[model samples]
Target: MEWKGRRQSDNIEDQRGAGPSMGGSNPFGRGSGGGFRIPMGGARRAGGGMSIGTIIFLVVIYFVLKMMGIDLLQVMGEGGQTSQPGFEQTETASRRSSAQEEETKAFMATVLAETEDTWSGIFKAAGETYEEPKMVLFSGSVKSACGFASAASGPFYCPGDHKLYLDMSFFDELANKFDAAGDFAQAYVVAHEVGHHVQNLTGILPRFNQQRQRMSEVEANQMSVRVELQADCYAGIWGKYTEQKGLLESGDLEEALNAATQIGDDTLQKRMQGYVVPESFNHGTSEQRRRWFKRGFDSGRLDACNTFQGDI
Candidate 1:
């Protein structure tokens, strides 16, 4: 990719060394794996509401426990469980030098700027305004509106805050561990999360979250696959626009496709557990991901990227 000297986005929030502490509480739940998340419903009080005195007493007790070195919220967050499994965690290699980190940050900013331009144009053409999302750059773990997440969760877009949370270390794992290396491959990861933001803006994510409330776990997982594939398709659309501007070089498309293949739920499952369970698949298979991305790249039309209608 010819990204040098290109315009960079100003919406980046660099919190590489200032990630959230482990004791923090995540009331909503852990964020989803890499992609769009279904907003988890908060626990509701049963048997009507508590009295004012009871509420005040509970608040006082909460602070008392905190002063005594106990966090009820943290305990609750830890106890909360979900059937959905997040992305696998891998040991990141030693951190890159300062120079390399800066370059990667610049590259990410430039890629973000490209997506902003592409999506802005597309939205304007459809008589809608595109609101650009902020990208948060953190190191180990970060607290988001969705919840607290580590780099193992990979790069994800949180609809609650309309922001993309990323840890650059994941890119290292993507290359060294997953064998998907290249600047364009890294760009694909960013584009995929940004695609989730686009879904949120289009009401797709909100509708999905609302519907998933009543859906069975298996049914929700199946629907999640479609949502993730659509994001991949959206990423491909950005790639198409980038290519038209003569930014994509030889093998860039393959780099992105390989990255998509490497991170597919099926491929990761097979590699991690030496088997695959189709029922637990939230993201699509390797072939499905690659195909959907190519479908968007070839057509470059919003309607062509619809994975929910008919066959994906």
Candidate 2:
């Protein structure tokens, strides 16, 4: 957990306060206008004059969504609008980072760098070049190639864009709401998402998607469980590598294990809904998650994370 003064990844996109309406233009650019212009690609522009009734209706809908805590800017491109060419097209909002938020960002960058180093070596040993994925930092909501997502969806890896999206507030929620705390726990989350990128690079994700089309709901959910469990195991593989480098302090492993358990499908379902549905459990149970992570940590081999091969 001692990441200070360590190498940091340069692939981080700091979209903390840039909202979607700003279009492909840099949302972080200095501007006194809160509203930014978004270029529409072969789509209807927003300049048409509206009747009073239409404006009133839209205004009411806006207020209703605001009451529900929905971000209006994030919905701009969700209607299938494509960005103009030459624009990065990340729909994000700009906001000032708090002292703690800045520290968390630094930690995330350092952990990403460590994962890059460890995985690069692992991939090189396997006679392959690792293509490191970008990690995006956002607040509230963000738009990606995969679609718009809110922080409530938690941290996710979008294979379509080959990037990991994170809302740093999730770390606070992890500690306070899920009872999983510590720097290592946050690192575990990043590693797990990065593990998804690894799966994407190895063709496991595409194969899973192809096969999932032929699967029943329960079977597809089971396949998803395998995918998620393998990511957890991959996170543990990174944990093992960091431990070898003397980067992990005492109790760091426990924090990650606790995090895995706390976010298990069964534990979360029971806590939120008072019951657990096995057929709907896409990420495995707490025991399964903890066991797979430990298995990878103990063996430190990619082959040890073959969760799809047999019963997990």
Candidate 3:
């Protein structure tokens, strides 16, 4: 991934070092493992699929599994409220990013810029305008329209606010714990979240939510798999752009592919629980993830990412 010297996004909101701010009254429930279990309180029934709470909770599970065996999902309040109020919300006096942190920040900014460019061109060709989403860089935890989230919550895109919330420390965890190293792997993560933003922009996410309300739990989980797989494909579409720009090296694609497999629902479940539950899988399996991404990479066409229509 040749990201240095590339343009960084000005949209990045640097909230690192700022302490968590309180937002609501509901507190997070503690899990037996000493981690927070996201309570499904204040969650309302959407039309056919999972509610926003259920969707966010399911996403939180992935972060929980990756967190060195810690559970961090918590229910803050209605509307995805994250943290309770009264905590100090101030930036550290000597706040400064380490050299590696600085480098990673630059890399992320470059990747974001590339995505903005690629998506803008894509939308223009389709007779539409691309609305680039902002990315929030925070440590510990931060608040969003979706609610408060700790670093353990992992990187997520809140359609409510049209921003990608990320904790750069997850990059280290991706390398050290998940064994998915390389800058491309990190880029894939960023791209995947941005892909969700794409879904939001295209109204796919809204439609999915509407359809999900009528689905059974198992059926809804299957739908969620489709959503996640499509994002993987979209990430691959971005990967295609990088490859075309001569930004990708020989092992770069492999790194992203490895990352796809590493974070597969089945892979994470098996590693964390020593077993796999197919029905519980929201994000696709390893082979499914790898294949969908390859599909997008091979075609570089938005139509190629229609995971909901075919036998994914």
Each candidate structure's TM-score, on Cα atoms with residue i matched to residue i, is 0.76, 0.76, 0.75
lDDT of 3 by residue, 184-287 (tens): 99999999999999999999999988999999999999999999999999999999988999999889999999999999999999889999999999999999
**lDDT tens string, model 2, 1-312?**
878999999989999988647566766666745545665554333766566788799999999998999868677765334543213333221223366788899999999999999999999999999999999999999999999999999999999999999999999899999999999999999999999999999999999989999999999999999999999999999999999999899999999999999999999999999999999999999999999988888999999999978689
Q: What's the lDDT for residue 303 in model 3?
A: 95
Model 2 residue 293 distance off true place after TM-score fit, in angstroms? 0.8
lDDT of 1 by residue, 19-105 (tens): 447677665568634555544655345745566788899999999999999999998666553322321121122233676899999
lDDT of each: 0.91, 0.91, 0.89
Model 1: which ten-residue window has the lowest total lDDT? Answer: 85-94
Q: What order do you get sorting by TM-score, best first?
A: 2, 1, 3
Superposing all C-alpha atoms, what RMSD in Å does each candidate have to the true structure?
Answer: 18.3, 14.8, 20.7
- Give the TM-score comparing model 1 with the true structure, all chains together: 0.76
Worst 10 residues of 3 by lDDT: 85-94
